[model samples]
Target: MPMQQRMEMWFQAWNSLMQDMERQGARVWPLIIDPPALLDEIEAREKSLGISFPPTIRKILQEGSRQVQINWSLPSRALDPFSLSGDLGWSLDAFEWPYFGVDEECEDDKRYLSFHVGGNGDMLLIDLSTDAEDPPVYSWGHETGEFLLLGKSFTEFVERVTELGCIGAESWNYEALACEDGLDVEGQVAQEWKEWLQAFRTLTLDEAVQDFEKLVVFAKMHGAEDERIQAAFAQYDWEQVLHVWVKHIEQETTSSNLLPWCQLIVKTVGKKAESWVLSLWESEHCERLGSSLRAYVTAVCLPEEEGLQRVIAEMDEVVARKECLLGYAANSHLHHFRAREVILWMEPHVAYPIEGWDDLFAVSRPQWLDLIRWLDGNEAQRQIALSAWGKMLANGESPAGEADWQEIHRLLDVAYEKAILRKEKERVDRIRSALETTMY
Candidate 1:
């Protein structure tokens, strides 16, 4: 069958499923098919752009745009329907699509045409240069610059969306209708509570407590056993939840389990949890925590300025104690909110033989790169960064493999070239000497 025909079939199936959902009283966005005049407008756009619309794309334009807004209870999939009307240009318009003689073309730009906009500013693009009759669908992240293949074709994409929508529709209880029809509300509530409990079993104690509280209210309304709910709550040691989270933070296991719990606590408890986390920051184990946990806790516990100050103060204390590695670790955490401060703090110590250069490099890669970019125009800062780079190259053990060694070499080469371009001869000579002595 033709790709357009398959897409039409998927559309019919999706429309029918959505109608059934509406009939069941589920809230769904109304599907709007573009009129013939709108289709003409799309054709006009193609003519103006000097590009031919693929058959599948033309069919989609003829069918019009759709917006699927699933209820909060359902997992979100895509953004609400975006159309070609008023400021909306097909997905390509939102991006810096290269035009012949007008803009430099990206290697991947010529191979795909963006067809849909995602909720998070991602674009759903259709591969145009592929040999397949129905080009594969790809998700392009504007922020991350990642191109992920989503589906083989437009038809498959629609089918997947419809499948998710159907699952969401089925998950709806239609509780009002069930009540009107004299169905067992208590039984339904009991089942949902069991599901919630099962989900909570996979979460940390902090997360479980937060979820359990909401479950209690919901259970009470549904006439579930109050004692059972209370017992379930009692099973979790609420008082120790923060301590457990702190332990995870100290051990750096929070990213695997406790970070989400921390996010939930911050969101649900808000500033109420701030004091508790702040107290934990004073603990001896705070230095052991991963940069992520430290940064997140600092972000949540204190305002930006206060957090930056706290990080700087901690760094100063560590430095005064002659714990240079710990000080560097503390400084690494401030890179996101206070990059300039980090640069300043590291300036005096750049040439110092810091023991944890590897740890600092791993944790502060982006910040280091940002600092380097900033240093590109300033001879003084570039020299300081170069000295730091040389020390790191000399003191840090080369990573295990050739690939890793090559990556380090590549970064060094880039920095060396930047120094040459900026006419920082001393920086270039230092980087060159370091590069010559490096071994995997």
Candidate 2:
């Protein structure tokens, strides 16, 4: 059948599918692809049909065959109805069953457990083992496909799984079986499990402290030589190396371990880390933590002239091209531009004049014109122009007189014809300079 016709058939089968789930005492997660909810459509279809499919029938239609969606609990989960409009007449049952499983640690004699379904209306079961720190052994069968292994019960299974650790094994552990051929199927199945085990088993608080101490010494003794290690030796909260560093620093020892760690904080994280720390600073509920963090940043990072100079140079570039830095214009990433962030950086140390109304006007006119052009459409454009013109005019340094208004309009028209919005600051600067000269 053509894809469009298959989609219609799926739509026609929607009522029967919902009834099937309800019959099995399972909640029906519909696969409707339309908005405004599929319940109303299902009701109308059911009323027209004068019958509903059994739970098995619904399971077959919904998941036993992947005609469309696997689950339809929300609008986001709904299959794209348009997708059904193509050649999509394949069935999920044709390839046996695909049961959706969740991560849970417990089940009776089961290390890993899941669900699947068969045509006989029976839900088959799947289970796996959890012997190694890495991915455990698991198994699956064709009968348990239609089940949705939910979270609450999964937690209960996890508790039981802890109890059953390594005592029982009746069948082949799917993960181990798959690994004998060197595939490490369970490892491939869920790599997060491997990472979690690695973190839990390999990285203890004490071990972390030892490594951190080593890192500190390595950074200070060979700051320039071991720049890579020094660079990598950051006490970043997310780093695997952080927990140890924090502990060692609190101990107040001054041996090689103590000196390097203290020095590492200054060398690696001190001044450079200050800006990053502020970026994450929050003033709401996290104000106390932010204050403490700021204190830490200040205490550890000694002011280095070289570091400060580099930071200042970066800030100056950002401030000079504020339009690009502020995302008011497309900027070449290689060439830095001026920004408010740079101004904030310099404000503490430098005696700088505050920008006035003229500066504001000079910065905004081009932005206003660009916005106007983008919004110049049908009703939407008309509404935006009417609503926004007053705000735009309010930002002008000197209000345009009759001749000035005529010139501004002409230039704007020229901008539209040119279809480019580059060098706007220069354009406005020239115009303002000419106006000043004419006045003098």
TM-score of each: 0.36, 0.22
Off by over 4 Å in 2: 1-63, 66-185, 188-191, 194-407, 417-440
Task: Give me the overall lDDT of model 2.
Answer: 0.33
CA RMSD of each candidate after superposition: 17.8, 20.5
> Over the stretch 135-165, how does candidate 2's per-residue lDDT look in tens digits?
2223333244322221122222222222211
Number of clashes found in candidate 2: 25
Question: lDDT of each prediction vs. the true structure?
Answer: 0.47, 0.33
Best-performing candidate as measured by TM-score:
1
Global lDDT of model 1: 0.47
The local lDDT score (0 to 100) that residue 419 gets in candidate 1 is 53
Q: On a 0 to 100 scale, what is the lDDT of residue 193 in model 2?
A: 31
